[model samples]
Target: MRTATPSRAMRLAAVASQAYRRVFAASRLAPLLSRPNPVHRTGYDLDVVVRRIAHEAEDVVSLTLAPTDGYPLPAWLPGAHLDVFLPSGRQRQYSLCGNPNDRSVYRIAVRRMADGDGGSREIHDGLSEGDLLRVRGPRNAFSLVGTADAYLFVAGGIGITPILPMVRACHERGAPWRLVYLGRSRTSMPFLAELERHDGAVDIRPDDEYGPPDLAAILSHAPRGAAVCLCGPPPLMAPAQRIMRSVNPSGSLHAERFSPPTVAGGQPFAIHLRRSDITVEVGAAESALAAIRRALPDVTYSCRQGFCGTCRVRVLDGEVEHRDRLLTDTQRRDSMLVCVSRAAAGPLVLDL
Candidate 1:
């Protein structure tokens, strides 16, 4: 009594089954399948659990996140930010400060902004270990180009979050890099101990002691062909940018801003929604997005600071006073990130 050999169709089916199982395995496909859909509009779609939370400095807390299913998290690079969905129904972006090579955990440090939009306050007071969080993006609007001969990193207070990983990358690659970490004081500065490990490469400037960083001297002394990566208050970055332009005209300078561009004495404007057949008045004190939301409540938006580009709308007519740092000059020709931008002239017609 001999057993019959399997047919060709049977063998092919077995192979296909194995392949399917392998592809759907926890390690291989979990991270890919867990990625948030870019077109989801509402932003946060992936769920993660807070594995640990520790204070990095005064008013600064670091959160380590892992996928709720215990699978590997999505891989990210230096200067990438994660949009953290808070329990208070607000989404805020925080830079991923941990090693980019670590796929199992994503770390982000948040500084309690005493006078912020309340997202930071929620993260500080509300979120805890074991809490589940909805998150989107390890998105990189400010990424290291890796083409420079040398690098200069300037971080102020919580701004150190994004630059920390970049410094590690520079160290691993043995690239010529210098870090200027500035804060109100040494005690307030997060990652001061970590940065001090690279003593020769870092300059910790506490404003109380140093008054302010000598932007002119720092830029002038920077090695030729160096790219300066700055993440800090606009007041600090604005001067550094000017000095960089004068000292090394050909050098590249990139900045990551945590705040929206200031609009001084903005004139009142109106928005005309073409498809919805509605008009909303944008008062001098309020943003266009706020006014539009009153009429169309379901409009998707996140990071009302204008950095996320989630509330962006196509403009059909009228001039725009584009104030967002996220858009390129070319993009401002027709589209506007309504979170910060307002009308330069009259009623701006939007596709809605």
Candidate 2:
């Protein structure tokens, strides 16, 4: 079963919600409207129930979710994710690990981080099949584009989730593709055996890729127009980024920031919304998106890492200092993900 994209009425509902929020800002209704509960407008929201669970690793659990009637599991293009609203009132997003082309059941592989704040543990112990959840979206920020070109996918640990689907997409189309997987061990890595069956070139660096399967050698074999996308731990990503940077421009490389870069130490900045046309100052302690969202609660966004394109806004004037992984050359030319990016020099005026 596949769910349809948001209807025209849904967008209208969002507009209505926005208007209601502004009009009721002085009344008690403002707080009610700003609640992070649910925005029924975009059918991107759904109700789901766990159908089955598999322990892929010590901490990872692969869950199969069933969609409610009229809200069937969406036909997600491979490399998409379903944003789940946890009971904790925070929305947690997970990549669709099942066959992206297969619409029968939506599957997601979740690794429980030792440092995770109970979300992982909930999937392990608290959640079970038949437990209904307010699930929203079969969203894909890491979408597959330019399939005609050669491809190189670099996955580190959980980063494999999005790439798995992309590989399948490329293979079915007979596009040339390779993989550079970095993990701590074969047992701990999810979908290890599945990748081996791909029959294409695969470089698995369990601890360090220091041996014959060095990333340098693997990258040397890349064909022209070969796009590279890396997802994994920060340590693996940094080195991978350096290698990709040496060969390809940022446009040729696609990445989803699993974690925010800790690069801090910039003076306070300001951003002016060209659409909303509101200029807000951002302190060093605050992110551009956090400052924008707090100042304008009507903005609905998901990932704050700029990995997800939900927080994207167009730039009308001034230069932007981009540190996000979601935008393309076209997107970068006009739009910026406020979640992770900040001003390079002067205030950036955006078209929200």
Candidate 3:
């Protein structure tokens, strides 16, 4: 006979008991853990000076960064992003929008969110040209594949940064590609004049003029074996995902989000901080990073989506259900990005 699964209350109770033991263990080992833990600086390796800052749109600014050493920076693909370290020690990720062929400098666009977590605000108000900023990898999770028969690019609001480079690449290669750029208005959208040079078909739909976008009608026109790339907010992405899965299941869909991606199928778990000697209970609906921040407010993190590898911590105990694509097999053996990854079973002991 199969064993019955534990109910939600039972599972929570078990987790609480485990948390108690974890707390006791942490306190017992407090003296031994007093030694300084080595800092994990995976993404930040290069220093780049801000060469220029141009207002791309009403609230968007594009920053061009050049190396201090006067060397060509590391080459990046179309959809790669950088982990930018601000003067305030806060980290934020931005997509590279410049021409990849030009190795002298890297460019990224930022849209100021008045109610955001202060990163964009600091960037808009505090940053200036010639300011030195440390940055990390131009890593790619949404790369343009050459093998696709055609490409359907959907960019919403300020999501045009990554798609801009991909469109340029396709145009240069004489490949078939179409872009549907959407925004609140022409004034708020960036890079319209730059996109005008491309003779390819581009549909610019502003909500003020076009009302709400009929995402189904737009995506239904995707050609067979088309690679559909979407970068937008949840309102655009959610429906687009449902429509694509139903209408264009044969085609592949790759997406990037300005906000953290929704965490699905997560179960409640506990994170035992080895150094802090505290236990953070992770809710099924929230990420472990969110829970830890409630306990330790000053923890450093860049992309909460697990691509930047900034929130990675050593897993001292418990099996981890690794979720991020950024970490290698060897890295997964010992550490996990708490922003996305979670405990495989029981409670986790983290060297935070």
lDDT of 2 by residue, 24-113 (tens): 544644333322211221244657778888878647789988865422344566666777776655567788777854555788888887
TM-score order, best first, reads 3, 1, 2
TM-score of each: 0.78, 0.67, 0.84
Worst 10 residues of 3 by lDDT: 34-43
Q: Which prediction has the highest TM-score against the true structure?
A: 3
Worst 10 residues of 1 by lDDT: 35-44
The candidate maximizing lDDT is 3
- Runs in model 1 lying further than 4 Å from the true structure: 1-44, 264-268, 272-287, 290-301, 304-307, 313-335, 349-352
What is the per-residue lDDT of model 1 for residues 257-334, given as tens digits with 9 covering 90 to 100?
887545568788889999999999988878888889899866767766766787899999999998786878899999
The TM-score measured for candidate 3 stands at 0.84
So what's the TM-score on candidate 2?
Answer: 0.67
Q: What does each candidate score in C-alpha RMSD?
A: 7.7, 11.4, 16.1
lDDT by residue for model 3 (1-352), tens: 6665678668887678556535643474432332111122223267899999999999999999998766456667788788888998998989999998786899999999998888999999999999999997776766777689899999998899999999999889988999999999999999999989765579999999999988888888889889999998888987777899888888888888888767889999999999999999999989989999999988878788876778999999999999886788999999999889988899999997
Error of 1 at 95 (Å): 0.4
Candidate 3: lDDT of 227? 94
